[model samples]
Each structure stands twice: as structure tokens, then as C-alpha cells.
Target: MSRPAVLAARLRTAAWLGWQIEANWADPFTFIVYSAVRPLATALILAVMYRAVAGIASSGQAFLGFYVANAFHEYVIRVLVGMGWVIVEEREEFETLKFVYTSPIGMFTYLWGRSSVKFVQASLSLLLILTTGWLILGLRWDWGAVRWLPLLLSFVLGLIAIVYFGFFVAGWALVLPRAAISVNEGVAAALTLLCGVIFPIDLLPRAVQVVAMLLPFTWWYEALRRFLIGHGASARLSSFSDGALLAALAVSTALFSCVSVWGYGVLERRARQNGKLDQARLF
Candidate 1:
């Protein structure tokens, strides 16, 4: 196929696969209960904590904003990380990895569809949390048109990062017979701990903070905080800066994604050569 033809085909495949994954989104009650619960609880806890602190000191909206942004961002991360391992779920249930290995289109396209759908599903939770907090709790919205561009950029970047990370997990599952469990929980826990979810990295010890900075999650979270909070509001073209940040993040995500996907392909192909692909099964 011509290069453009191939690209179009991949995109179509991605769309089809994305729709399939989305169709499996949790049922109404499950979606509401699972997606909204944690963030709602977190928001409430932060509200009380902030109210206590503000009682004795000057009142500020920064904490409220930061809490909402970080909590929402963390939920995004959860979606990204979890989507990475869904391939394993398929492998365990019906040996779908073999089918993926033999598929006509590139694995990346199929994976993109699946992960993108899952990301949307996971993000739904945050949407509920943020909207409820913003409208019901009287949290202020900055209402800046252009200044909020970075927020969208960060979200896109975070999504891309999840795809790259998912490649590593999928590759591990392909190469190591029983590696999916560790890949799933290990990546999830490591990201949650290091991504400034529960606490910002600045509050951590110097050494731990340095290590956390090396991971992609920190950058994702930091960019999210800046974008959602209108970091460049003082600038004349705050909206332009927001767009620029989004563009930069998009490029970075593409670069990392290429590297990670290439690495996974290499490992998966090698596993096939050695008859180790079957080891990916749970049984």
C-alpha cells in the first residue's frame, strides 16, 4: 500500500477498534459509582482540610484548584496505565495476544483504538468530579478562553504518554511468559506514588523528588497543574503560550511513543522466533 493509504487504513482501524473498546464502557451505575467515587471523596477531604487551614490563615483558592486539578489528573493517569494492561486481560481470557500478533494491520493501530477508548472511559470519572466541584462547591472557574489552552495540551500529552507506557507493558507480556501481573500493578503503583498524586513531589525528600522527576508522570502532572490553573495568565498572549505548551507536549509524546513502540515490536518479534509467545497465557 502507498504510505498515505497505509496511514488512512491505520486510522480507520484505530477508529473501529476504539469504538469497540468504548462500547464496553462500564454500565451506567458502574460508571457513575467507580468513576466518580474516589475523586468525590478526595475533593471532600481536601475541602475540609483547606477549610481548616484557611480558618487560621489567609483564605486562598490555590489549594482548591490544585486539589481538583491533581485529583483529576491522577484519574487520567489511572486510565492511561490501566489501558496499557488490558491486552493482558485479553491474553488471559482468550489468548488474544496471538491474534494481535498475527493481525494484518500494525499492532499500534489496534492498540491505539483500544487505549484511546479506555482513556475516554477513565476520564469520564474526572469530568464528573471537576464539574460537580466547580458548580456545586462554588469553586471558581478562571473563564479565560486562551489561557486554558495548556490544559487541553497537557491532557493530550498525558494520553500519549499512556500509550507509550502501555507498549512497554504489552511488550513485557509478549516476551515474558508470566509478566503481565507485575507489569500491570508495578507500573500503576509506581506511577501513583511518583506522579505527585497524593502529595506533590516538592514536598518529598530531595533524593526522592529527583528520582520522581526522571519519570514521565511528574512532567504530565506538572503540565496539568499549570494548564488547569492558568499558569501564564500574566502574559499578553496567554492563550498562545497555552497552545505552544500543548504543541510542545504533543511533540514530546510522539517522540517517546515512537521509541517505546519500536522497542515493544522488537521484543515481541523475538519472542515469536523463540516460540515463547504462548507463554503469555494465564493457563
Candidate 2:
């Protein structure tokens, strides 16, 4: 095959491998239950939190839309967690990392291809969560106020940054296989809280807020709230125009992806040198 054809074939095979591993792990009924329960539970948790703060009356309509934004944000967590988690699984659980490394296809390309299944799974979860938010949690649409430009830009760029962030986790996992178990989850939880998953970064401590401001997910979530709900959770984010938000997301995407690539190379080389790639220890 030609170069582009070979690349496409590698990506396709990796994606297919991922799908079999993910979806064929159990029977169809079990798979259905597994997929539906977590996202529904997540929606319920959001509703419970909303009710705890205040009753779901006229005033709660604002947070109902916030639920919409939160539903879409689910994919960010999925991508962030899935990328690195796969590395741990392949290395320790499946004993395939050394074999994968021996393949002609680049590791970065292989990992990205494997994560294509996550994008599909997250899309399904997004649809399910959005439905639950609308039907069970009082989410509603406001088409007139939606700003398509920043919304689209943030979604596209934010996803890029999220995947690269996962790549960042995967790089470290190659060397620290045990810590790999929790690395992506740790990263996801930290970003989810700090990046304003359901709360404003402005409410976090000043130093933490400053840290959040520098992350791409913060810009993405802020833009989602502003454009989708007509405003954000804080004045700092709400005051920025669509162009500003997109520019921040774009710039951060570029920077984060570069770091992800560079860091992955460094760590992968170290793993190769130290014979860490094939080590699988269960504790």
C-alpha cells in the first residue's frame, strides 16, 4: 500500500480492534445495561445537586440549561479517561504493548486510532444524557440565543485538546504502568472539577482559578455555557466574546497538542531503554 493508504489501514484496524474489545466484552444485554447506567446515574446526580441547592421551579431553569452544557461535556471526560486507560489495559491486562510497539505504524497514530471507539461511545452517551436532561431533568432549548461560531469552534478544538491530554497520560503510563491505573482518571477528575464541569471556576480558590484559566477545557466549558445558555457561571467568562473564547481554545489546543506529542516521545523512548513497555505487574 501507499503511505496514506497504509496509514488509513492502520487506523481502521486499530479502531476495529478497539470496538471488539469494548463492545464484545459481554453479552448484548449486559453491554446495554453497562452503557446506560453510568450516564443516567450522572444525569441523576446533576439533578440531585440542583435540587439540593434549590427547588426545581422557575428559577432553576437556568441550571436546567446548565445541565445541557454538562451533558455535552461528558465526552471531554470520556476522551481524557479513555486514552490513558487503554495504555494500562494493553500493557498490563492484555500484554500487547510490546507487540504494538513492534508494529510499523507509529504509536501515536495507533493510540489515536484505538480511541476512535471512545468518540463513538461518548457520542452515544451524549445523546442519552441529553435526552435524560430534557425529559427527566427539565432541560430546554433556546435556539435564538445560541452562537454557532464559538460553539462549533470550542467543540472541535476542545476535543483535540482533550485527546492530547489523554495522550499526555498515556505517555506517562508507558513508564509507570502501575500509576497508569489511576493517571487518566486523576487527570479527568481534576479537569472536571477545575474546568467548571457544573460550577464556575471563579468559585474555586484564586490560585486554582488561575490554573483553570490556563486549561483548554475551562475555555470550552465557559464557551458552552455562554453560547448555549446565554451567559456563563461567572462574569470573567461571560464577558468574553465568541472570538475571544475561540481564540483561547485554538491557542491552547495548539500548545497542549505539541506538549502531548513531545512528552509522549520522551517517555516512550525512556520506556524502551529501561524495558518498561512489556512489564506487567498486578498488585
Candidate 3:
């Protein structure tokens, strides 16, 4: 097979391998049920909190929509982080990194394919959350009002950005075998706190807000809010036009992708030089 064909084949095989590894413990029906319950429970908590705090004077449901959307889209962060953390899991626990390297597949193809399963699971949770919100919790979105073009554009850009991040994570894990767990949690927490997940970026300290602006997640989330709710959660960025949001997402994700790919190459070289490819250091 040609190189592109080889990469495509490897990605498919890796994705299937990842799916069976993650879901084999539960039958398909049970796995779907279990995944559905966790996000719904979180959505319920956000709903109750909104009720106690705001009580229906929702300024046309902005915060209600914001928090609830945040609750349900938990998959975004989990998939992003899980993509990074998989390096540790497969390399250390399964003792399979060297085999994959020897199998002559590009690591990038392998990782992206493995992460696809998380994206699938997360998408399912998001669908359930959106349905429950519209039916039971009053999320205030109109299917008619959604800007499908911009929404899909931002969504695809966000996923591409996430794949870049996963590559960086796997690369760093190659070098910092001992700090894999800490690195995974630290990246996840940073996204959770600073990427405008729980609150708008404008509400963050001005200095921190600058860092947040550099992240693709910050732009991606705001773009999503605008596409879904007709306005964004950030007052500071409200003046930015739709064209500007798309431009910012494309530019920021591209820059970040460059940085991630560069960092990954550097780290992977370092790891190979130091003989850390199959090293495990959980302790």
C-alpha cells in the first residue's frame, strides 16, 4: 500500500482497538446507558443551581443556556484530555508503544484514530444533554435559529485544534514518562478553568484573559455560544463580528497547531534519544 493508504489503515485499526479496549467491559447498551447518565446528572446539578440563583429571570436564558451547555459538553474537554492521556495508558499499561512504532505507523495517525472513539462517546452525551435540556430544563435554543454553517465550521476547527493538542500531549508524555498522570490532569484542569468553560473569559483576571485568548478552546467555545444562542457569553468579545470569530478560530488554531507539531517533534526526538519510549513510571 502507499504511505497514505498505510496511514489510513493504521488509523482505522487503532480506532477499533481503542473502542474495544474502552467499551469491552460493558455491552453496547449498558455502555450507552452509563455514559448518558453521567452528563445528565451534571446537567441536573447545573439546572438546580441556576434555579436557586437566578429563578427564571434569565435575561432571556443566557446564563441558563451557558451553564447548561457547559455541563453537557463535558465531552469536549474529556476527549481533548483523554487524547493526551492515552499515550500513558497504552504505552505504560498495555506495553504497546514500541510495537506500534515497530509496526511502522505514524504516531499521529495512531493517536488521532484512538481519540475518535472518545469523540463519538462525547457526541452521544452532547446529544442526550441537548434533548433533555430542550424538553425538561428550558435551555432556550431554537433549532431554527442555529447558524448551521458557522456552527459546523467552528466545530470542525475545534476538533482539528484538539487533535493538535493531543499530538503535543503524546509527545510530551514520551519525554516525561514519570509525569504523565500529572501532565494529563494539569492540562485538563487548565482547560476547565481557563478556557471559558465554567465562566466567560472576560470575567477572568485581565492578565489571565490574555493567555485564555491564545487558546483555541476559548475562541471555539465563544463561537459555539454565538452560533447556538445568537450571542456569546463574553461581554468583552460581543463586539466581534461573526466573520471575526471564524477568522480568530482559524488563525489561533493554526498557530497552536504549529506550536503543537513543533513541540511534539522536539519531544519525540528527546524521548528517543533518552530511551523513554516504552518506559513506565507510575510510581
Best by TM-score: 2
Q: Write the per-residue lDDT of candidate 2 for residues 52-108, one digit (tens) a residue.
A: 755655226567545766777677666667878788888888998888989887787
Task: Return model 3's CA RMSD, one decimal.
Answer: 2.4
Estimate every model's Cα lDDT from 0 to 1. 0.62, 0.79, 0.79
> Which residue runs does candidate 1 get wrong by more than 4 Å?
1-32, 35-62, 74-79, 176-179, 231-255, 273-276, 280-283
Q: For residues 66-139, could you state the per-residue lDDT of candidate 1 as single tens digits?
A: 56555655444455555546566656655666676577766666666666656665667667666766676666
The weakest ten consecutive residues by lDDT in model 2 span 56-65
RMSD of 1: 5.2
Give Cα distance to truth, residue 156, candidate 1, Å. Answer: 2.7
What lDDT is obtained when candidate 2 is compared to the true structure? Answer: 0.79
lDDT per residue (tens digit) for residues 159-195 in model 3: 8888898788878888888887788788877887787
For every model in order, what is the number of clashing pairs? 1, 0, 0
Q: Which residue pairs come into collision in candidate 1?
A: 146-239
Query: Whole-model lDDT, candidate 1?
Result: 0.62
Cα shift from native, residue 9, model 2 (Å): 0.6
